[model samples]
Target: MQQQEIKALLSDMSLEEKIGELFQLPSYFFNGDMVTGPAGELGITPDDLRVSGSCLSVVGAERIHEIQQKHIEKHPHHIPMLFMADIINGYRTIFPIPLAQGCTFDPGLAEKCASIAAREAAAAGLHVTFSPMADLVRDARWGRVMESTGEDTYLNGLMAAAMVRGYQGENNDFSKKGALAACLKHFAGYGAPDGGRDYNTVELSERTLAEDYLPAYKKAIDAGCALVMTSFNTLNRIPSTANRRLLREVLRGEMQFDGVVISDWCAVSELIPHGIAADEKEAAVLALNAGVDIDMASPVYLKNLKELAEQKRIDEKQIDESVLRILTLKNKLGLFENPYKDGSEADEKELLLCASHREAARDCAEKSFVLLKNEDSFLPLKKGKESVAFIGPFTDNQLLYGSWSFFGDEQDCVTVKAGVTQNYPDADVFFAQGCPTADPGTNVLGFQKTPPKEEFDLQEALDTAVELAKKADKVVLTLGEHRDYSGEGASRADITLPSCQLELFHKICEVNPNVCVVLFNGRPLDIREINQKAKAILEAWLPGTEGGNALAGILYGDASPSGRLSMSFPYCVGQVPVHYNHMSTGRPFAGDYRTTRYNSKYLDIPNEPLYPFGYGLTYTAFEYSDISLDSDILHKGDSICASVRVTNTGERPGTETVQMYLHDVSASVTRPVRELKGFCKVFLEPGESRVIAFPITEDMLRFYNITMDYVSEPGQFEVFIGSDSTTSRKAVFSLC
Candidate 1:
């Protein structure tokens, strides 16, 4: 099945058959087949399902094989249905969340995690994964920040491309069954929703969208992602699903994304609600004309496309184009020849949470945990001497897998208590849950079950934790938001640790002053107070299936915490959209907050984030020398090399994410105070020194200006190179 074969098949498909290819219906198997699932209520008949080209959210290897085989028998053309699912971070062998993965700033490690996910998911016969979500999130309140890498444009682009490569492999060949066609999702500014709320309006200028928002997606395409998904939110005033200028002009024409453009779940139908289309028929017409290739979980295309084509409301050629794209992807996957595609109950069982995969998960989580604060080096605690109390809701609970770990079994997750016991069996280890992780309506992800009636005793739990703290030499207090607090429809106004956990921490600190706080969260939390109270703080954002094993390794000094922050942690929730690479303000706050009137400063707090982007700490420290440039100035079309020598200033071996930032001293349009251009991660032994060099080209300085033209105006530029974005080791150079 090649391009020629796809073209011939497109010609042979009937109108209804072609329409079926455009519609991707939902499928929730096993106990979730009805009552609350999307498939049972989506109003799709057997005939409709048979002709459908893809089914999403279906799980189990054997079930997928059954569906595809059954679908082929009913369809006249016998085109096998593609199995798609949101295997975001991992399949069964979960790794750290994408946010935590990004903190490593090691695309190589990100690639490894994605490769493991691809292998586990391929065992389940998935043809495509809606992953490597390239959305650049600046706000912590955006729940899907759990899925995003972080706030920066360049950093996100690097990780996005790496994931694409990992998913698609060297070529788009899953012949041996590991790689899948990666879908770069929520195309065009889905992360920048208004108010940092999920699915909210997105208003952005052409320059901002093209410069900051579009790069990551474009990078993914360049890495050969097989598909792109339309966003739920509107870009500018037009919804992305129906916006022809976006889907056609920017994506298809400008970016040359010839891959199948699929809509997010129900986004095609939601265009009617967005006031763009008057009815479902118009929605279908707009979506096709706008270049959306598939309607995901929306019956609008299946119901109205045929009628719209007959009525001459939409061109039939648009239908042919979309069907062609789908068939071509299927051809690339070799699905036309082998529809089952290595799916079997036996293979799934063999690959699910296998030993090597668990080890990979452990490695990923170990590198992804960031030491936010380590007062007097309280961490890397020796297991034999210090009797420790691991008291928290997360201590015995198997909720380590974050949201979107759809295929992972929570029971399979190794708990902190179990991991600790495995490591230090004889040590006196006291454990108590500070509070319930979530009680009743606390879940915001639309749980249809009756809300639990709770009589959770906050003070009783606190007193128990306090008593345990007094008995142990040190208390390992774990705290975080409920699992449902991030990912999908889970935006929060507070963006802090749950109140019960915070209150429990205060009470426990009254008994044990040498307490260490281990944070298990999705998005970055506002923990200004917790950092102040605790002797040590570890930010392990939803470390995946083997989270406990990885946490144990870090706590016991088996590995040093190496992850850096991809997104800035806000000083408070009031500073919603804080980041390190913000554009320079006309009136910069030069003095202290109280003294800085008429300047860009917060009344209650400083404008700076609690922790800047690219910030992280390990058991050891690295010292950076002032940057050395190859030349003071250079002409256009020339490149300059900036070099910095980093020394492992501390005794222990550690990994450091070396970041390089650039600033145009003067530009046609006002530029950011600093923009990340390049970075390198290096592991150093004690007294080790290595010189890392970054080659900067003219293209790195280009940006959209007032006329919407991307240009790099010749000017003096400042280059900063160090461990993080706030590095002051600087050198000056000029471009003419």
Candidate 2:
């Protein structure tokens, strides 16, 4: 269908039919049974289901085909229903979480993982995926940080654009097989909730919002993302779902996003609880007028939109515009020609968890594992000779896939015990459960099912682990928070390992001189105690399906860990929202002024993080020389290159992510000490030396000035190029 045809169809739709197209209901509403459960409680009637434009969280090709057949048979306009779900990281063949993928620092690899996820999801009859969350997160206490790419605007925008390309394909053609429309989510400042709580208020100035949070979403939209989902939080004092200034003036107007806009789960009706609307009718009017084209999982649009239009309280033209956008998306998906576009049961069977997909997952996990500590080069253990003891809750656990793996089966996951056995068949590998992943009676959200009952005695498990640690030559202590601990609605006040696990580790360390720690978690943890006690530590954050195999490869000399930290690991929970790119203060803390109490410094702890952003360790070491600039001045229409020589000084092959940072020494407003501008991941063999060059353009220096305009002023700037954010190899230049 073309533009004229879509417009003609919209003109023919009745007022009630157009209103129905704006409501998105769940899959159970179309089950053909009497509404008597959650749907009935929500006041969703049969008429609402009959004309709904889309369904949420629906799976299976056969079930989707059946639902589409039933819906088309009854829908007044015969518009096909769009099937959408939370296919964030993976569908069935799970991969590393978004944070871990960011550690890889390879946008190409992230794109591959998302492409595979899209293929698996498309085969299962999913038409849209609510993913590529472009939120910029700095607080580890926020559980949803696991879903973001990390703290840097450049890296977040880079990864988000790659994911958009991966999901929609290069041509943005959803009509092709294995391509699903992508929806960038949690619009505005969903990642910076107050106190790091979920759905809490977000307080940010327009400059900060534009300079930090909005760029990533704009990157995805510029890459042709088909839809944008309103966030649950309030930007400033207005809820994002009903903030016309945010949705209409900013997102659709300034961002130039002419795509369908959908509300987050039930966010339209949530305006009432948010103290912005009086009732359902007011909520519907507010959201539709604010530029929300679809109300997801909410009955306000179904129950009140028609009446609001009839009473002249809301414009009917808004209804027609929204219905047209929805129809345009359907036509873009080629659904008008074939409602069940390429959904096949055979394709699902052939694509899900295939060998190639497993290999890709393993490779990504290998690149994503960060070697945070490698004292005395204790890793790459003697596989066949050493008697190793694997002690802790995650030693043999199959729950390696983290939260939001909607369709992945834990039974199919490969455990660490199994991976080690496969890699070191002749070694004596002992195993013991140090303690449960968390204490009993832990509070889990109702949406996330309750954990299984702990059947073992805690003291006994600790004793068993200690004895095994004493007998074995080396101990591989595996530990982490439970999988449900870090996801949506799973925020925590303390971001550290459980007390029982800490006790178990202390006891084992007393008996064993050599210990290697493997962590499976979602967010950056407070690991001060673990850092002091362990000889080696590997941050394997929620590696999916082939997690064990990937860890084994790194431990047995098969691969080197090249992953870097996207978010900073704090010194303690009190240093909650720490990042590298913080604005410079008037009274800044300095080493020379440590004795002075008047400066901005913490009395008990350092202001810096335990591990700063872009910080990580690899098996091999790389040496960097001083940065050399091609020119000392940069003018408007030309660019200069900054070059640095990096050599693999250690006796092994490795990959190094050369990072380039810029500092605006004098600006209209306070600027960060250093900001990441460009990066390159280079692979090298031992004794190999390569010079990496980054082209510096004036456009890269632009930022929101004091007057709220994006521009760059002429000034002297400092540049640093090296391994991580703290590198001191610097060069000076001027923008004239």
RMSD (Å) per prediction: 2.1, 1.2
Model 2 pairs in collision: none
TM-score of candidate 1 on Cα atoms, chains taken together: 0.97
Error in Å for residue 71 of model 2: 0.7
Q: CA lDDT of each candidate?
A: 0.87, 0.91
Clashes, model 1: 0
> Which ten contiguous residues of candidate 1 have the minimum total lDDT?
445-454
Candidate 1 lDDT over residue span 710-732, tens digit each: 88888899999987889888999
- Cα-based lDDT at residue 132, candidate 2: 93
TM-scores of the candidates in the order shown: 0.97, 0.99
